[model samples]
Target chain A: MYLIITALAAAVATAFWYKNRLNDKLHLGALCLMYWGAALMWLVDCVAAIIAGEEEIIDTSLNAALLGICSVALGLAIWLILLLIRSRRNKSQATSINSH
Target chain B: MACFAAPLAEAVITTVLMKRFEKKEKMTDAPNESQAGIPWSRKLKWLNNLLWGGSALLALEHIWHGEIIPQFPFLTALKEPGGVLPMLGEIATVGVGMAAFVTLVWFFMIKIADARAKKAAVSGKTAETEPCI
Candidate 1:
C-alpha cells in the first residue's frame, strides 16, 4: 500500500514536471495529479503508522486538522506563485511600454 | 530535533530567497502589478513554515510517546526490551518525513511558477519588450 502511494506520487510529479515542458500545457490536469499524489502519500503513511502500532505518530484528530491545513496551504502556495510570476511579467511589460 | 531543524532551515532559506527576489524586483523596471512590494506568494512561504513547525511538534509527540524508546537502549534501563533512548532514535526518521512534506510544497510552487512563466513567455509578453521611451 505504501509503495503504491509512493509510486503514484512519483508518477504524478514526474508527469507534471514533464507537462511543464510540453508546448500545449495541461496545467489543471497536472494540478489534480499533484494533489492526488500528495493525498495518496499522506494516506499511505498514516495507515502504515497505524499498522506499525504507532498510531500516535500523528494524533488522529489533530492529524486530520493538520492535513486539512496543509492542503489549503499547498493550494495557496501554488496560487500565489502563479500570481507572482504573472504580475511580475505584467509589471515588466507595463514599465517598458510606459518608458517607450 | 534534527528532523525539525531541516525544515526550519529550508523555510529560512526560502524566506531569504523571497526577500532577495523582492529586492531585485524593486531595483528593476518591473511593473508594480498594483500590489505593493509584497507578493501573495510570500503568504505561501509563511504557511509552509507554519506547517513544518507543526509537523515538528507532531514528531516530538511521537518520539516522547512512541515504542522506539522502549524497544532499545544505550544502557538497559529495562532489562528485557530496552530503554526508550534507542527507540527514540527512530524519531530521527521523522526527518525523512519532513523532507517529503517540504518537497511536496516546493514542487507545487515550482510547477505553478513555471506554468505562469511559460504562459507569459508564450503570450509574447516577456520576449518582446515595447520601447521604454
Candidate 2:
C-alpha cells in the first residue's frame, strides 16, 4: 500500500510536470528521480525474496521492504521542500524584475 | 511498525538534504547547476516519473494477487501465508516492467526535444525556452 500510494503521488507529479512543460519552474525532475529510485530499490528487494524463496527469508525481506518504504517517504519530503524553496525564490526574482 | 516510522525519518532526512542543497544553490549563484552539466532538477523529473510508473504497476499487480484490499487496515491483508515477501516479488516484477516503459518514453521525449533544438539551430531561430510556472 505504501508503495502504491507513493507511486501514484509520483505519477501525478510527473503528469503535472509534463502538462506544464512550457513553464516548468518547479524542477519536478528531482522529485521523479527520488520516487523512481525508491521503486527500483523495492523492485530489487522483491526479486531477491523470490530467488531465495520467501519462506526462507521472510524477516529479512520485511526489513528490506521497510527500508525501501522509508526511502520513498524521504524522497517525497525532499521534493516538497524543494518545491517550496524554488517557488519562493522564483517569486522573489519576479518581484525584483518587476520593481526594476 | 517500521512502516509508520519510515516516513517520519524520511521527512527529517529530506529536510536536512534540501537545506544543504539550497545553501549550495545559493552559493553558486547557478540555481540550476549542481553537480555538473546535468541540472539536478531535470534529473529529478525523469527519476520521479520512473518511480511513479513503477509503483503504479506494482499496485496493480498486488490488486491482481489479492494482496491489496480496499478495506480498512489494507496492509494487514499481506499478513497471509506467503506474507509480504511474495508481494514484494510481485512488486519487483511489475515495477521493473513499468520502469522500462517509462524509460522508453523518456528516451523518446529527449530525442524529440533534441530534434527540435537542431531544427531551430539550422533555421537560425531561437529555440522555445521553458519558463518557470
Candidate 3:
C-alpha cells in the first residue's frame, strides 16, 4: 500500500539527509520533506481505512503496488529536478568565481 | 470523505502566514554570526511543506479511489442522501487529527532545531551549521 511505500521512501530519504546534512548542496531536505509528508498522509489514510472497515488494510495487489510506485516516482521526479537546478546554479557560481 | 481537505485548508492559511513572515524576515538585517539561527519563516516553511505535499497526494489518492469526482459537488459522498453529516464527521475526526498530528510533529522539529541553534550560537561555531536548520 501507499503507506508502506511512503514509509520506505521516508526511511531512505532520512538516511540520505543524515549523510548529507553537513554538506547539503543537493538539498536532500526536499526529498525528506516530500516523503515524510507523504508518509504522514498515508498513515492517516490507513488509520481511517482501518476504522471504516471498508477494505483490507494490507493490499498486495499489483495495481495498488504500481500506483504507490508511481506516486513515489512523482515525488522523486520533483526532487531530481530541484537537484539539477541546484547543481547548475552551483556550477555557474563556480564559473563566475573562477572568472573573477 | 475528503479528509485531506482539512490539511489543505490549514496549509492555505499557513502558506499565507509563511509568505508574510518571509517578507518580514527579508526586511530585517541579517543576523550576525553570534546570532545565527533559523528564522520564524524558515521554521514555518517546514510545516508548510509538510502540509502541502502531504495534502496533494492524499487528494490524488482520494480522486483515484473515486471518492472524489470532477463533477458538481465533487465529493461522491455528498451524493448519498443524508451523507453530509457522516462526511463531516470523517473530516472532523480523521482530517483534523491528521493536520493536528503533522503540526505537532513540526512543533517538535522546530523545538529541536531551535535548541541546536541556541547551542551553536552560544558556542559561535561556523561548523554548527545552524543556518540549515
- Index of the highest-TM-score prediction: 3
- Residue lDDT tens for model 3, A1-100: 7778878987888788787777776777767777788788778767878988967876778877876787788777877887798789999999999999
Runs of candidate 2 exceeding 4 Å displacement = A55-74, A88-100, B1-133
Pairwise TM-score winner, candidates 2 and 3: 3
Q: Whose TM-score is higher: candidate 1's or candidate 2's?
A: 2
lDDT of 1 by residue, B60-102 (tens): 3335434225454412333445544543453345445554565
Off by over 4 Å in 1: A1-100, B1-5, B28-91, B124-133
Q: Provide the TM-score of chain B versus the true chain B for each model in turn.
A: 0.43, 0.47, 0.90
Instruction: Sort the predicted structures by TM-score, highest score first.
Output: 3, 2, 1
Q: Interface RMSD, all models, one decimal each?
A: 11.4, 8.2, 2.0
lDDT of each: 0.46, 0.51, 0.80
Give the better candidate number (1 or 2) by lDDT: 2
Model 1 error, position A67 (Å):
11
| Model 2 lDDT per residue over B1-133, tens place | 0121222233344446556665666677773221133334443344344444344334444454455577855664365665677546544554344445445555675555546555655555432533222
What DockQ does model 3 achieve? 0.47
TM-score of the candidate numbered 3?
A: 0.83
Model 2 per-residue lDDT at A42: 46
Stretch of 10 with least lDDT, candidate 3 chain A: A22-31
